[model samples]
Target: MSTDQFTFTVSKTDGTARTGEIRMPRGVIRTPAFMPVGTAGTVKAMYPDQVKALGADVVLGNTYHLMLRPGAERVAQLGGLHQFMNWPYPILTDSGGFQVMSLAALRKIDETGVTFQSHIDGSTHVMTPERSIEIQGLLGSDIQMQLDECVKLPCSDDVAEKAMRLSLRWAERCKVAFGDQPGKAMFGIVQGGAVEALRIESAIQLAALDLKGYAIGGLAVGEPQDVMLRMIETVEPHLPKTKPRYLMGVGTPDDIVEAVRRGVDMFDCVMPTRAGRHGQVFTRHGRLNMRNARHAEDTRPLDAESKCAASNAYSRAYLHHLVRSNEILGMMLLTWNNLAYYQELMAGLRKAISEGRLADHIAEVKEGWAKGERDGVVEPIDDKAIAAED
Candidate 1:
């Protein structure tokens, strides 16, 4: 560990909104950070260097995917995930708890751990809180999440309470297993389904652990938007304001903005990249679908102001053709555009919070998206102009 040594220091605050940085051996991560999901060791279509250029301070990897495909031991043997994936920056790895429940089949959960068949090849595996820590350590992750049971939203009161309590016990075991890794930290996940009281209890218990950070888990798993916000509100006051707060698998540009206003610090979601693969791209004005027929003739960039070349250099008409033809560049460019938009949004939130104008900033962002439309017709790109640029 460096002098920073796995710490979060708050620089400024705006109501529930605040700005800060998390210091790790890998680097310093700006608060209100949006971490792109690098499932199975890559961030889908975008390369690691491109993801870095997009201003991301960190990225997330799934233990379930890596352990299933390449195996954690193999990754460790190959000089850890950073060398293996060519990403030298910080990486946060999930504990394999959530994916096991959601993706795996024939799952059996007990006090010790969960045993399930892999979704990929139907291979058998067991993931306990200790083993989850071991796998993350093998991957050399900077931030490691505890293996907590994530009950789906809308579970009965009895079931929610049961899972929440179980997760608390598992958190303790994960803490012990994580055991004093310098420059690295273990984060306890708060899981309580949609129950406000249960969410509070979970947060209270995890905060007492003096963990390096905390995460709001078991949400965005089919709950309504307001319900998820309510859960955050219920848990925020109970968590220590000093530790970094992560909202796991929760998302969208709007969701990130609202969650920042509610005191959450970090976020990881598949929405941006996943949407990109399907021809959807996000912009300051609004979202765009390249697969639409009207875009066949329109000639405009996704956003002229965006620093990313993909957003400013390529025209919508070109993107439309690529997506329509199922070209690989379509996925790459859109994924690039979407991730750039998310990182841009996070930067805006940080700046607004530091300036004590987060509320006004949030309103402005939403209004821009609400009042505009990307549907107006425009003349096609001139062949001569396109050829000259190329």
Candidate 2:
């Protein structure tokens, strides 16, 4: 687990979905990995140990959030994010370009980077590609993303192409700023709106750099599911199969499944944690909103067959009570259940790919979601039967 080098090994492939491992100095990440967003150096409500225990090999840190709050230099003096957050695993740091658009106010973009007033305190700051890379390095990020402009949907072709070309140029600057590290990596983000030609052009240009990995950014912002999937398809053919392909800030269970089917190897999203805080948790029966009065008298666990205790041990009624009362335990348990569900989904996808039954697995997974929950006390699936399915 300890090394001064980074490498990716693919074990199996079923259509476009892959079962693989990303070996780094810190640890090995199992692919198609789901990284819980630990923005501002934490995964919000959950503890570090709990996040790792949910099968997360890595977690994401937000450069803009950390830089604005505790300040990046302070974190460096305090021993970097992993040591600061007590997560001794691989940490992928976003370049903050997305936030330079979403979180900052009065933003202005030029070749030098983004100049904007801080959303938190209205302080002025500039986040150039080099500066963004420097900030991530100061945080000692294991995997760093390059700075890129992400335009909202419905923008003109000229606007999209302009942003895409600028991002390609910045990707070069990031490479120079990142320099080299024995066990670290820098990934490029592709941006081109909804245009297939622009997506292919951006992908080809980024691939020419032959960076450690590549991410299809600028989707899931407002586009429909089919649009997002189409973009993935457009770019996948031009990307390097040997390296990892990531889809940033992407989505629901069905979203993840569909993206994986199109060859995306990594993902990071706030949906599970954010939804949990809102009294919602994912299950085989689809999303359950604990605030519903129908659960007030329900005694059955959210998913008695779930491997996570949060989902299998506590009754829906108790969860509903906690959520209704605004209890911290409600957030913690729901977040735990949601993360467990995501990890379970990833595990199933990996197994299906390895077993050459990805189609069957996908059909079963979708069917389970559509069938909804069973009535009364649900019987847990036996470990042996589960193994047989695998």
lDDT of all predictions? 0.90, 0.90
Q: Candidate 2 — worst ten consecutive residues by lDDT sum?
A: 381-390
In model 1, where do residues sit more than 4 Å from their true spots? 1-4, 373-390
Q: Write candidate 1's Cα lDDT for 89-204 as tens digits.
A: 89999998988988897899999999999988898999999999999999999999999898887899999999999999999999999999888999999988888888999999
- Deviation (Å) of 322 in candidate 1: 0.3
Candidate 1 structure, TM-score to reference: 0.95
Q: Any idea what lDDT model 2 has?
A: 0.90
For model 2, how does the per-residue alpha-carbon lDDT over 83-162 read when each residue is reduced to its tens digit?
99999999999999888898787899999999999988899999999999999999998999999999999788999999
In candidate 2, clashing pairs total 0
Question: How many angstroms is residue 331 displaced in model 1 relative to the true structure, after the best TM-score fit?
Answer: 0.3
